[model samples]
Target chain A: MIHKRITKRKIIDKLVFFLSSLSVIIAMIPLAGVLIFVASKGLSAINLEFLISLPKPPDEIGGGIGNAIQGTLILIGLASMIGIPIGVLAGIYLAEYGDNRFGSLVRFMADVLSGVPSIIMGLFVYVAVVLTTRSFSALSGGIALGIIMIPIITRTTEESVKLVPNSIREASMALGIRRWKTILFIVLSTAKSGIITGIMLSIARIAGETAPLLFTAFGSDVWATGLNKPISALPLIIYRYAISPYANWQAQAWGAAFILVSFVLLLNIGVRYISRERYKK
Target chain B: MPHSFFLFRKIKLKKIKRILSGDFIFKNITLIFALFVLSLAILVFYELYSRSQLSINKFGLGFLFGREWDPVQGIFGALPFIYGTVTSSIIALMIAVPISLGIAIYLSELAPGYLRSPLSFMVELLAAVPSVVYGLWGLFVMVPWIRDYLQPFLESILGFLPFFQGPKFGIGMLAGGIILAIMIIPTISAVSREVMLAVPNAQREAAFAIGATRWEMIRVSVFKYAKTGIIGAILLGLGRALGETMAVIMVIGNRPNISLSLFEPAYTMSGVIASEYVEATQELYLSALIEIGLLLFIITLLMNIFARLLVWRMMKIFRGAKE
Candidate 1:
């Protein structure tokens, strides 16, 4: 009787355990579904014309989103230019001279900034930048995106910097080297891989952000070359197209989604590779 | 005489070099930049406050709790959006926390080694997927599916419950919560898994030696040991859900109403601001949205601090126990 009861209990335990694991495995469907669906459909829309052509009117069957692609590149490029230097400097402070309370406070604020909703950041930039500029501009949008990027870059830089051993710093300092030179040459160089990973990852994240751009860069159905004019981006275009009443627009929206997802995915994969390489070293 | 003059000049140059070293400049510059980072909060607060003076004077404290937001008449209140924000996020947390904890437990103790990394990677990938994609998927796929299938099934079983009763709308608090839950699950589970994995092997061995089964051992010792970190993980997830914007905005139906029915459409603070900030013609309307942003900022800030404290405390305990 005892042996039979033990066997039954074991069976129950095994069943529960397996079911729990299966639930997690099942969760992968949504992720896989998105990648597969977007890739197949998005690939169809990625011909030469699609890459170079402007968005067509609602009645048109298959025009491209060239303007949006260019605008997105501009915004992301400007965002990196503005965010990278400041973020790296701030990160240097946290890692090197971060024994002080102010350093801790900055670190904490950066963490909080990371958690703040992207839309809230957009509203902030809208009020601070777009309203002041008197019109939506690519510059304002870039700044807004930069604000979103800053916290991520700062945090990642700090983590990467911390991973570098302090013995290098001490050795340089003992050689009568300046604290700054030691950090820049010895510490930063050592942590360069991780730092690069952080930058790439932050870029990937900001590229897909739609909310902030909505309020700052905004929508322009036409091509944009001026900083003061409203700009088009993939995320914004997707948002607009997805919500349109037209079926063609919906397909375009799917294509836009595919482009945005792939862009982010490739960037993420690159970042992971860099981080892994750093780990291997 | 020439030699004496050269020695004096060399001493002067060395003095200058010592005073103006690259180390001194680099450290000071870094320190200044760090100081600037904290000062951004003040800058944002002051700038927004100055710009919002007109609205603040117009709406005063009544703006926050007022139910109506008629732009033409210049009436503005944020009660409904705030209500929706808290309710939907709380529901998301309630649903996500248990499932995430279960997944964490399973990944930590039950899963085969081969399945572990891939499963973990997939969950993390879900997190890395952008909010906008989530918004699109939530609208096109999840929302319709829920409306067509899940709603009928849920209402059939729980129809008597006030929260479950209503029309099966394609977008509403329930849909938002589900999407939010899905978005945050990976965050919670990944962090929770890290915490659970960090639990000492000795503790598990002790539990096992006491004749505890594998499941019991995990429940009693591993989970107990990592409870604070687990709490931190949940809080972190809650923070994400509370501040989620694009996905919620896409599917939340943007109705500014305080209702008990989960099937009814509602508006989150982030969603309201995202949808209306561009078209907000009135000063009060604009400032009211800014205030909502401020509120969100403050809430997220507090949650992050709490989460950091929890994780720090857990680390200390684990370290202390080990030492």
Candidate 2:
């Protein structure tokens, strides 16, 4: 007997689901609050000069973020130099040559490493690199960030390479290609797009990292020159500016936030674009 | 000439076999390299152990139970930091978990298809925002809001409870916990949403075929199947919360006090390390910090292992059952 039943359980269920979804929406408050506040106050200052000027003193009401922009680019470049090749190679080994116990172990380790907190990695770098050097520097920060990037790239590379079909590998082998040559010439070419997405995501992950850079790179308010000295980056600059007593500094902090957010969002979009391109072909 | 050609053919076959064996060797070498990734864990543990040995020897196990940290006279205890870490993380999870679960359920079972992806992506974007940014927002906005409104309101009502006592600083454990909750919500929501989405539609349909309503069907089918996955997600968020540094340090008002009051200033393992790892001068002081690092590492490591096992076991069970 099928009855049209509006049961108590049904009412409770709907209520619970509604509450849950509403709370999720509620959780967005802090982020939305921050973004709107920053945009209104920070948007007006996002001029060419703000982008170009080095941080002036607290009294200097308007200044640009030239040093910060330059430092971030250099750090990203150094991090990629250290991280991408090693991660790609490691991933290649796992995907192509990894059919054994060691491969499984490596894959597991990479996952575990990926789960490790970025702060711990920074601490590790500090103890191993920074303390020994006896000073904070961008190289140290880049290395710390690179440590965080490696596992991300490795896992993405492995997964991307694994996605390439065995048929392709077999075809290369049938042509009498050596195994390594088959992997390099055929497998990597197929997996390059996904690998690029992984790299971009890794870049995004490191770009927002503040903890690792805190003790390692050590922020500079002034323009930075070499690897040995402390450098100004957007995140560090934001932290400094946000915490200061001055109102103008606080406004500048919001501008820096806009810059950092834009970079991360662009990286996210870039990954999406690369992945779409791969699928289209 | 025929005999010589046969000999050459034999050599060629042997060479091919050797090349195949070399390929096998190369494969094994890759596996070895993968295994080397674990060596990082080993390396971290070893470095922390040796570096922290002095503190361990000096304080013995009592250091963990000890309640004071006096850097001047070399007397140190980690009880307060330990307490701060556990309490704040627990508080953050308590606040974040329910809200995150609600979000996951809403996105998976309630939201329209077009809205799900964008909505979920927006939530994950919160995770993408740097901790330092959160720190800035918390210090400038949240802290002030708490001091101005939330703390006063909470204190008047919960005044009997010590956790709400003392004048509001806008930068104490309560504010820290609230900030941490904001940070962890996206993590839990993201993972739990994936798990909830992984639940089979067939099971939901089966429940509905028995005249179950939408909510009842989800309760009977999806939630049951995804229980372990949800748990793992929560654990992962907990692990992240435990090791969070920059943001927590910025607003946690780092004083090593073991007050029951949530408004009191406190220091976490990570917060302490980030704040002081730079100027750690004395050997014992440095080792003390490393010991704290080691402790935090161990806690997070165990949490991660638990998360991995839960995920692995659930996946294995589900896949095997499907097969």
Candidate 3:
């Protein structure tokens, strides 16, 4: 009877193991399906004309997203300008002198800010920037994206800066370096790779954000006139085209998605590579 | 020689003064930036509250319970949205929780060491796929498949149930729920896997020492130990499902209606805001959309804080145990 019980337990264990493995397989189907479908459909839609020319009217075929591409670049540049300095400095404060209640409050708030939905960020910017400025501009969209990047960059920066060995700071201080100097010259350099990785990841994240850009950027079909004008972005274009009734627009949507996904994925992989290299040292 | 020594001392003193000023300036500047980060959440809340004032005054507390949402008539209510958000999120959790748990278990317990890192990376990649991309896929691919096959199959098998009784429009609560499930699986499994890994090896060893099978050991030790954290992970996933906008908007048919059947069209808080905010021409209409956003913001904020606390507490317990 004991022998039979042992066999029964063994069979149960095997069954549970099989079920768990099967769950992983089931979970993977969507990921694989999405990647494959985007690539296959998107590759055919992309070409020289698709890259260089402007989008055709909705009823027409053979238009490109060149203006959208330029808009995306402009918006990302503006966002980086706004997000990087503020995020890095805040992160520095948290890492170097943030052992008190106020510091913890800031950290917690950053977490809360990160958890706020991207769409809400759009709304907040709309109220603050768009309503006041009285137009949907690339500036407003960049601000929205910039705010979303702040918390992610802050958290990652703090974590990576914390990972820098205290001994390095001590060594700098021993040389009569100012505390700020030690942090700026020694600690930050030591954590440079991780901090860069964080920034890249945040960029990847905001690059594909669609909701926040909906009202803020407002999206234009023509070439962007100025930072003060409505600008097209890859995500906004994809969302617009995907929902429209035209088959050609839907096809263009896939192409934009392919480019966006490729850029984000490559950045993520680059982050992984950089972090691995850091660990190797 | 004395004059040269005095000059050198004077230069050293000036350099010290500069360093002190630099440190002071740097510290305060960074502090200002840090304060900006701290005040962001409060600012968002303030902005949302102040902007939604029109609706707040107009609807009062009854807004959440009122079901009508006609913009032309200026009769706004949030009940259908709240209903859709809750029901769709509940459906997502129901389907996602088990599969996520299984994946977490496999990753933490059963997977060979060589296979673990790559598998984990692949799961993370699932999350890295953009929301819009997912929406595009759901629109073109998943929705059609659902309309033709999955909904029909479910209706055939479970047609007696209220949820399965309606016509299969494919773009409804069920489709939204399934899409949400796929999106949140990565989050739940990743967190649960971390929590399970934090369960001390001693618990497992003790279970094995009693001649318990591997599955039994996992059930008695790992699951029992990491239960709170797993719940927290599930809540985190729920929080994500609640606020998901684009994909659900694409597939949920964007109709503001309340129904028991999952096959009928529905609208979520985020979905309504995304679909209608730009088009809202009237002051009250705009304010109503902002109010929905406010509700979504508060719910997600509370959910995230609570879930983070649970996960943090659980990790702390494990860390203390290790010490």
Candidate 4:
């Protein structure tokens, strides 16, 4: 009886392992499918003209997302200006002095903020900035994306800063450095790569966000004149084109998607590389 | 001697001034930024609440239960959107939870060490794929596959069920659910893996000491130990599915109706807001969309808080065990 039970148990173990492996495979199918479809469809549409020229009308055969790419770059620049300082400072406060009720509350709120849908952030910016300005602009879109970036950056920054050894701070203070100087110069520098990794990951995240830019950027077809004017973005164009009935527009959507995905994936890989370098040290 | 004493007193005062300008200023600057982070959530809530007051006053609590969504008549109700969001999310959770748990188990326990990082990286890459990209793929690839193969297959096996009885339009609750399941698997599995890893090795060793098989050891020890955390992870995934917008909008057929069939078209709260917020000409229409946004915001906030608390508590328990 005991021998029979052992054999049965072993068989069950093998079956369970097989199922677990199958689940991993199942999870991978969609990823592979999305990547394969985007790559194949997008690669054909991509060229120098596609990258540098303005979009053509839907009935027109070929066009580029040059304006959208430029707008996306400008928005990223604007978002980073707003997000990085606030996120890093808040993270510093949490890591250095946030051992109390208030710190816990901030941390919890940051996590909650991160979980809030990107669309809602768009609405908030609509009410706060876009409505106030009376125009849809790249600035409003940048602010929306910046809000989305903050909590992500804060959490990652806090985690990375916490990874810095306490002994470094002690040594800095031992050398007669001021407390603020010790943290700003010594601790932050020590955690620099990790923090950059976090920043890059957050940048990658905002790069792919579409929902927030829908109304705020409002998506112009022409080149954006200024931060105050309407702007186009890669993901926004992809969304607008994908939903339109025109086959050509849909094709352009795939092309834009290819660029967006490649940018995000590259940023993620760069983050991994930075962190790996940190680990090696 | 008096001159030297005065000079020493001046030096001390300057030192005090330097401290005030440096550490004190630096700490306060960071504290202000932290305060901003904390207040952002409250500000979001306030904004949503204040912006949606027109609908709140007009529809009151009945907005949640009423079904009509006529933009011309301006008789907006949130029930269908709420239903679609809840149902799609439930379906996603149903599909995602098992696969996620399995992936978590494999990654945390079963996979060979050499294979683990690459597999994890692939899963992370799945997440890194943007929502729009997912929508594009869902519309072009997955929706066609559903129309051609999966929905018909489901109908053949489970045609008697209400969910399986309808015509397969390919862009409906089922597609939304499946797409959402794919999107959330990485989140659920990653968290579940962390929770499982937090389970002490001693539990597994104890299970094996009783002559249990590897699967038996895991089932008895790790699952039981990490049960709350895994549930928390599933809830987090549910929260994500509930608020997902662009992907769901692309393939969920974007219709406003309450139906039991998974093959019928539906609209989610986020989806409606995304599609209508731009075109809402009427004040009440805009307010109604904002109200839906408010509801989505509040529901997701509550779900996240509850889930995070559970995960936090579970992690705390393991830390206590270690100590």
Candidate 5:
């Protein structure tokens, strides 16, 4: 009876392990399926015309989202300007002077900010900025995106700053250099690749975000000329076109999705390459 | 002698100011940025509450429990959305936990070193895919697949139950749950894997020495030690599922209903806010939507704070173990 029980226990353990392995396979289906399906459907729609012209009417066979691409770049630039300075500076504070209770509070707030859904941030911006401005604009969207970017960039900056060895600081201090100068010139330069990687990741995240842009930027079909005007974006075009019934619009949505995914993926890999080369040393 | 002494004192004052200025300026600037993050949180809550006060005053405490949600007649209640968000997140939790645990185990214990990082990156990629893309996929591929096959299969297996009695509408609570599961699996699995990795090697070796099987070692020793971290990961995942908007809105059929049937169409708190906030014409309707945003903000804030506490404690434990 004892022998039988032990053997049975072993068998049960084996079964559980097999089940765990099976679940991993099941988890991969959506991950791989979404990418593959989007690629296959979106590839045929991509051409030069798809890259450099205005969106066509629903029935038109082919049109491009050139304006949306330019708008996306401009919006990204606007978001970077708002997010990076405060985020990096706050990160420096965390790394350098954040051993106190105030540091922990900021850390907690950063996590909370990350958890706030992207759409709600848009609504927050709508209440705070859009209402005052009396209209949707690229400025509102960028502000919303900038808020989302802050905690992410801040955390990454903190981690990378922390990773720089304490010996560097000690060495600088021994040379009679001031603390702030050492941090700003030596430590930050040493961690530049990592910091840039963090920024790149932040950009990639906001680039694909659609919910925050829905009401804030309030998509336009034409090129957005000024900061106060509504801007077209790649994700918005994909969303609007995908929801439409027209075949051409749907095709363009696919094409745009392809481009968007490709852009984010290439950016991730390229940034990783730059960072990893430094990490290897 | 008096004039020379006064000039010397002025020179000393200027030199002190110059010496302290650079370092002091940098610290204060960064400190201001850090303070801004704290104020940002307070400002969000303040704005949400201040903006939603009109609805709060009109509805009193009844806004939460009231069922009617009519824009035409200026009636608003958040009950359906609350019910929908909680139930869908529960469904997602049920579906995601097992799969996430599995992936975590595979990463931490089963996978060979050669295949580990690549597989981990692939799982994280699921997170990187935009939520809208997931919505599109759910609408075009997953929903139809469910309507034609998965729903029918579930109905046949459990049709006697009330929860399974509804017709397959393709996009509803179950679909929302599935999409949420897909989105949240990465956060849970990634964190859980880190937790598992932080499990000490001595525990594993000791279990082996006692003649425990591989699974037995993982279950009785490794996982037991890392329980808090795993729970933290699940809570973080729950927090995410609750706040998810776009995919839920796209595939949840946008109906306001409280039903036991997962196949029935429903609306979520965030979903309703996302779908209707822009089109709201009445001031009351707009305020009501802001109230929902406030509730979402409060709920997510509480959950995240609790989750972060658990994670923070787990990190302490790991640090102690390492030392």
Candidate 6:
């Protein structure tokens, strides 16, 4: 008998296996390349002066994205206020009372909404808010981000709420409590951690968004005040600087990118750890 | 009898009851909140339709097929952009699906447990790396590499084909497609891996009990079992590549012309709108851009619905099996 039969099928199987393994190795290259390059280049740009001071003129040497950092925070904060309530409430509706046609429609819309190119959301906000306001505002940027957040948060909330077993809800309902009370007090509390994770994920998503805020925020040269005037954001600044002819601005762009990437990556890692621990429970 | 009596009393009391009853108020409000999702789409459509009326009226149905996009002549058409969007997304899908499926297979069925979780996490990290960062990398690292080596190499080998006939500009449809494929790999792979994992272990055992090799077992049991889910995952990836803005905009060279050649500069629907919308001061031009946005919105929405239908079908199958 043959000690090792080298049949045609065996050779083909080995080849296919090798190719699959090779493909996964190739896919890992991009993640490693992007992370290493961004971190190394951006690390030098992060200093006390860069973080705390206002931007210098394009021709100048040292500047910070302080205004942009503040603007991004304000924009995110405002967007959260607008988006989280609507998203969480709609999610609650889907979880608690969404056994009908409207629920399915909302679910469908949520999927479609997430698929909308972020730039379109920007345009919608630009037309709906900026045109009415007669100027670009943080309000418009918030509106754009808030719109983007709705679908993500809605889907996450629904999934998490669904995870709370029916028996738990039944127990709550069997008590002398109203349906809404049972949902709000019992089911929602059980799902709070998951819902929060969803919110964090949404924030991480919109935080790096540049296309949606391009026209909505319209960029600012100086420290802008309030939500009326145009505001600079971390992503908008990165885009602007990355395209500029000046080297210093480009450096600043790298620094800002480092910050943005670190923030997003850390948030994602944190959420994953939390979710994994919860999974073990 | 008591329940019926209470229901009758409640029905009678409803006319005199305050409208602000907690149950009624909360349910109707949340329902209204749910309806906002539908209204968001409708409002976007209405806004786009009303805003783009001038362009819609001027170009009629010809706008979709007309090729010229010269804002200087006040003429606008979306065909090239549509071509670029469709072709680039197709390229992304073609490149990404196989590799992602491979990764899914490796991660789920082949990789040992010690290696699997970290590898999966790393892939997920790529998804969180942000599009702008991807765009930046594509511009600084990939485009130059493509221009210098990849395109020239491909052109030399495949020059006889029309698709490789363009001049070697690194930032073009090919570059855009590659970047998109990278960005989408994590998503498609993760979803496909989940689908593969959901395939029962008995199938693997049964396949092994036969004379099935590793690849053969996966192909017959895991892959065939999760085929619909994998399709849904690929479609979702396709939808994502279609709507991706900043990364594609950066790498696609933003030329408003269509050609069969992947090496030439081209524009996508989202790419065009992103770069041009803010500067499009002309009435027809702005309206035309908005109209393009409307078109993109419709396309992606449809794509998503189709993908979701596949996923829903998969869920039904799972439930049916469980029962």
Considering every candidate listed, which one attains the maximal TM-score? 4
List the pairs of residues colliding in candidate 5: none
User: Roughly what TM-score does model 5 have, to 2 decimal places?
Assistant: 0.96
lDDT per residue (tens digit) for residues A1-281 in model 4: 98998899899999999999999999999999998999999998899999999999998887899999999999999999999999999999999999899999999889878888899999889878887798999999999999999998999889989999999999999999999999999999999998899899999999999988986998998998999999999998999899899998998899999999999999999988888788898
Interface RMSD of each: 2.0, 2.2, 1.3, 0.8, 1.2, 1.4
Give the per-residue lDDT digits (tens) of candidate 6, residues A117-204. 7887898898788878879999889989999999999989999999999999888778878778888898899998899999999999
User: Which 10 successive residues of model 4 chain B have the least lDDT summed?
Assistant: B15-24
Which lDDT tens digits does candidate 1 get at residues A1-281? 98997787678678668767765865676787677767776676677777778898999877888899999999999899878887899998898779778877899888767877777677778888888878999988999888888888888899989998888889989998877778888899998988888888889889989988989999787888798899999999888888788887777778888888888888878877777677777
DockQ of all candidate complexes: 0.59, 0.56, 0.70, 0.82, 0.71, 0.71
**Candidate that beats the other on TM-score, 1 or 3, i.e. the better one:** 3
| C-alpha positional error of residue B70 in candidate 1 after TM-score superposition, expressed in Å | 1.7
Off by more than 4 A, model 4: B1-19
Model 1 clashing residue pairs (backbone): A180-B23
What lDDT tens digits, residue by residue, belong to model 2 across residues B141-229? 88989899999999889898877898688888988898889999998998888877777778888998998877888789988998998
Error of 4 at B118 (Å): 1.2
Candidate 2 chain B lDDT trough over 10 residues, lowest sum? B27-36
Q: What's the C-alpha lDDT at position B251 in model 4? A: 95
User: Alpha carbon lDDT of residue B219, candidate 1?
Assistant: 77
Candidate 4, residue B297: lDDT? 91
Clashing pairs in 2: A50-A64, A53-A64, A102-B31, A103-B31, A106-B34, B163-B262
- Cα lDDT, model 2, residue A185: 78
- Per-residue error for B89 in candidate 2, Å, reads 0.8
Query: Candidate 5 residues A1-281, lDDT tens each?
Result: 99998999889887877877777888889978888988998898889988999887886677799888988898899899999998999999998888899999998899878887887788889899998889999999999899988988888888889889999999999999988999999989988888888899988889999888987998887877899999999888888887788888887888888888888887777776887697789
Model 1 misplaced regions, further than 4 Å: A1-16, A170-176, B1-19
TM-score of chain B of 1: 0.91
* Best-to-worst DockQ order: 4, 6, 5, 3, 1, 2
Tens-digit per-residue lDDT, A1-281, candidate 2? 12325657667877987797788779889879867876776687688989988888999777878899888888888889878877887888888767788777777778777777888888888888887998899999888888788888989999999999999999999999878778877998989889999999999988878878887888876777899888778887887787789988888888888888778878887887787677787
Docking class of 4: high
